[model samples]
Target: MTLPLSGLAFPPSREPSTRVPADLRKQGFGVRIAEQRDLGFMRALYETLRAEEMARVAWPEGARQSFLDSQFTLQHRHFTTQFQHAEFLVLEHRGQAVGRLYLLRESPRWLVIDIGLLPAWQGRGIGGALLRQLQRDAQGSHAQGLALHVRLDNGRAHALYVRLGFREQGGVEGLHQRMHWDVPTAVAQLNTA
Candidate 1:
C-alpha cells in the first residue's frame, strides 16, 4: 500500500539536508535534492544499472527499453508516494548528475531506501564516502542505527555494508537481505579506528 508524502505520521528531526562534505566537495562530488529536470537523467541511470541483467534476455531492443521505462516509472512513483518523508537525492560529480541516494529517517533508525551509481562511477569509493556521511548524520541526529536491503547476488555491496559494520537481520527468502548498523556499534568502531 502507498501513502502520500503528506500522510506520513512521523515528523523529521530536521529538514532534509544535502550538504556535501568538504572532503567530497574537494573531490568534485556533491549531492542535491532531485528535481523534475533530473527525471531524464535518473531514468537513464536506472537503465544503465539494469543493462547487465537485461543483456541476458533475448527480447528485442524496443521491448527491453519499454520494460525498463515502465519499471522505472513504477519504482519512482512508489518511492515518491510511499516514503513521504524520504529524501530523494541526486548524487553529483562536478555538478553533473551521476547517481541517486534515497533515505528516510524515522525515530529509531534511518532507512536507506536506495543508493545507486552509474557503472562508470562504481568502484571509485564514492558510494563508501556517501554512506559514511550518512552514518555520521544518523549519529548526529540521534538515530539508533541505519538499515537497508541489498540484493542477495550483490556481493560487492554486501561486502561494503559489512565492512561498514552492518550485520544481516534476515530478509526475503531469495531476493534481498536486510542489514543494519547500530549507533553503538558505529561508536565502538570509531573509537578503535
Candidate 2:
C-alpha cells in the first residue's frame, strides 16, 4: 500500500531472484562510515549535485551544510552508541573522497536521505558499485530493504535504482520518489550461492 503523495509513483524493487551484475569481485574503490572530520568532503559531494537541479529538489547552496549536519546526526550517534542502521558513508577512490551516501533506517525501509558523487567522479561505475555494496551490506539489518528518495528529476539515479531492483513506494516530498529494494531476498540469494 502506498500513500497518496504528489509526484510519487509506487515502484517496488524486483524479486530477489532478479539478476544484478555479478561484479561484486570487481573492486576499485573503498568505503567507510563517515566521521566528523570527513564532513567537509561530504559537503563537497552535496554541492556537486546543485547542477542536477534535480527537478524536484529545492536545496539552496547556503543550507547544504546545516542540512547535512542534521542528516548525519544519527550516524554520529551510531559511532558511540548502538544503532541497527548505517546512516553515513564516504566513498573513496585512489585515496580521495569522491562521494557520500547518507541513509536513515525506518523499520522495513532504509531511506537514502542523501546520495551524490562529485563531478570529477561521475560517469564511472562508482554509483552503481556503491548501491550494490549498500544493498549487500544492508542485507542482515532492519527489514532488509533499501529505500531512497530521488528528485523526480534525478533520472540518472532513478534509472540506477531501478536496475538495482528498487521500486517506487508512492510517496513524494516535492520531486522525490520513495524507492525500496528488498534486502533479505538479496541476502538469501547471496548466502545460498
In order, candidate lDDTs are 0.80, 0.60
Candidate 1 per-residue C-alpha lDDT over 1-193 given as tens digits, one digit per residue, 9 for 90 to 100:
2213232222232445856677889988877777666777878898887887888999987788778877887888788778868888888888989899989888678899999999989998888888888888877766778999998878999999999999999657567899999887667466446
In angstroms, the error of model 2 at 66 is 12
Q: Give candidate 1's error at residue 67 in angstroms.
A: 0.6
- Residue 71 lDDT (model 1): 82
Model 2 residue pairs with clashes: 10-168, 10-170, 11-167, 11-168, 12-167, 12-168, 13-167, 144-183, 152-175
**65-156 per-residue lDDT for model 2 (tens digits):** 45545544433344324433444566666567777665655666666666678888777776787678667666755456777778887788
Off by over 4 Å in 1: 1-15, 185-193
